[model samples]
Target: MSKIVMFDMDGTLLDLSFDDFIWNECLPERHAKIHQLPLSESKEKLYQFYQSHRHTLVWYSSTYWTKTVGVDVLKLQQEFQSKIQARSGCIELLQQLKEQGYICWLVTNADRASLRLKLDNIAIEHFFDVIISSEQVGYAKEDINFWQELQRLHPFNPDETIFIDDTATVLKTAEKFGIQHLFNISQPSSLKDIKQHQDLEFKTLDRLTELLSILNEIDRKDNDVKIA
Candidate 1:
């Protein structure tokens, strides 16, 4: 069996702009109908509410829907799922990796609820062998406990568990946790404007069709190899 590779969804595979589109357009378009508010007002309220809780568990998963959205949780999730999904080539990317004999898992900082919504919308929920969420462990990617929990669940040699993300902070933390391979999205860093330790990076994932080639280049190189 090929080694396991972990993927970060939002800024890594899913188009980043799709986030703004969903929160700003698709979601509010549905929300306004349910709440009987003006579309503009609903959009503004949702945006403001999200800004305050973007990094929390409530924002990431169904907790927010059950407690705050005032509707059937599953129904609201189905509604949201109908809105945004993975970007073009997302399924193809995973399929290609699977065909290449790699075990692919979605490792994200997103709360379970939010992540499930996105995955269901894409209808590729089965692509991952596991969906690791920081919410379950009570620590975001910034904390190594999340990684420790993941390691306990599925032990992968650090030199083998590849992490692809768009955030430099998580990239650094993953590196520290001993994940040997880390690739920053070939785009502007979304989490923070910071330098990275990895030499391999991408600009924009217009064609993750290139991943196969990149994987071959991993060289199974030892951890001592520094960023070129």
Candidate 2:
């Protein structure tokens, strides 16, 4: 099997955070302005409502936000696409890994449309061999089935693959699916105490080049023969 590296997009390859930037700043602000609600009151209420339904489309969809927030989903999604990147640094890491021999891929929970908007805005689509989201898999990353499906599509052996994400729950699910290699992101806020189970867990790196160098050395050593 080919050596493959799969990364979670939201907090691992991209920046850590729930991407509330749009809901917190843009969407509510736009809705308040357009609907003539008190800007401060609207921003406050909308932000609070968004927080209430965090990790859900229940508030953001026509079934909910359209009635409660009084805005079109299409329009709000457009507005969200306008302010996509709330943080930085991951694009450079992606570039470095792509230049190295590793076949990099992205596995995320973000829905397809939102995922496309983020990738398009960042102009980093070409780096990934494939982008799979939990929505398409019909399960969250917490389920072993999600990764079993990933294997069905990509066909990479668990031994040769390293999966990285910010959630321990999902990492455990990966292990259940037979992925022995895993990394919980090192960022404190995103940290999941992955040390006991991970091959490597580092918060910051001077360069991805360093990772590549280590991999090269391992490959060279593995290829060298030993006298019995």
Candidate 3:
């Protein structure tokens, strides 16, 4: 069987500016109005709240944030749908992966409604063979148990699977769980510059052809070992 390649949606395959706009600007503005607080104050308070729950399940839960911040997040997502876009070369990379024998999956922390909205807005839903959300598994990617449960429900060879993501925290968690091939996206959003990381990292999907070469080399090495 061909190797499976899993991707993180927001930053790995899609541009992350829409999410940044919603969290930093759109939601904060509405939150200030609802509470009669100054825009600056609301933004600071929300940032603190986000910091407190950085890697937890609540951090990614739209339902939790909707009730906590008193704003309709999905509605705001729709309003800012125009900002949804694919990262440069991401669509072409997906096309190339399809042409090859690899399987593609979308593994994200985004809620189902949010995922559907973004997919519709970007029109890239057909590229994935499977879509799994943290909401469905009841654990965030930062949690080691999340990876364990993911393996149970959707079996894939850890040695043959390649996971790419933008978040350093979640990538570390996946690494701890014994996943062999891990790649980090240093620049998930165009607004951000490339970040330095100790692990295998790339600034854009344009280097994915290089990754194919690496995987092919690994397969050849494994085949030679088996023959010996």
lDDT of each: 0.69, 0.65, 0.83
Q: Model 1: how large is the Cα RMSD against the reference?
A: 5.6
- Top candidate on TM-score is 3
**Which window of 10 residues has the lowest lDDT sum in candidate 2?**
188-197
TM-scores, one per candidate? 0.69, 0.66, 0.92
User: Which tens-of-lDDT digit does each residue in 1-228 have in candidate 3?
Assistant: 878889999988888878998999899999999999999999999999999988888888788899989998888889889889888878877788878878999999998889888888776678788899899998999999989999999998888788888887888898889888888776788887766554444322334455667667778887999999
Q: Candidate 1: where is the Cα deviation over 4 Å?
A: 25-59, 65-77, 187-206, 220-228
The numbered model that scores best in lDDT is: 3
- Per-residue lDDT of model 2, residues 67-177, tens digit only: 677766445656656555523456666677777667888888776666776787767778888888777776677777788887887788886676777666778788888
Tally clashing residue pairs in candidate 2. Answer: 0
Model 1's alpha-carbon lDDT is 0.69
lDDT of 1 by residue, 1-228 (tens): 478889888877776655555555666776888789898998788788887876454665556654665444545445645545465567888888888788988888766767766775677667788888888777777667778888888777877787788776777778889887777766432323434335544333335566667777774443237543
Runs off by more than 4 Å, candidate 3: 197-210
TM-score preference between candidates 2 and 3, better one: 3
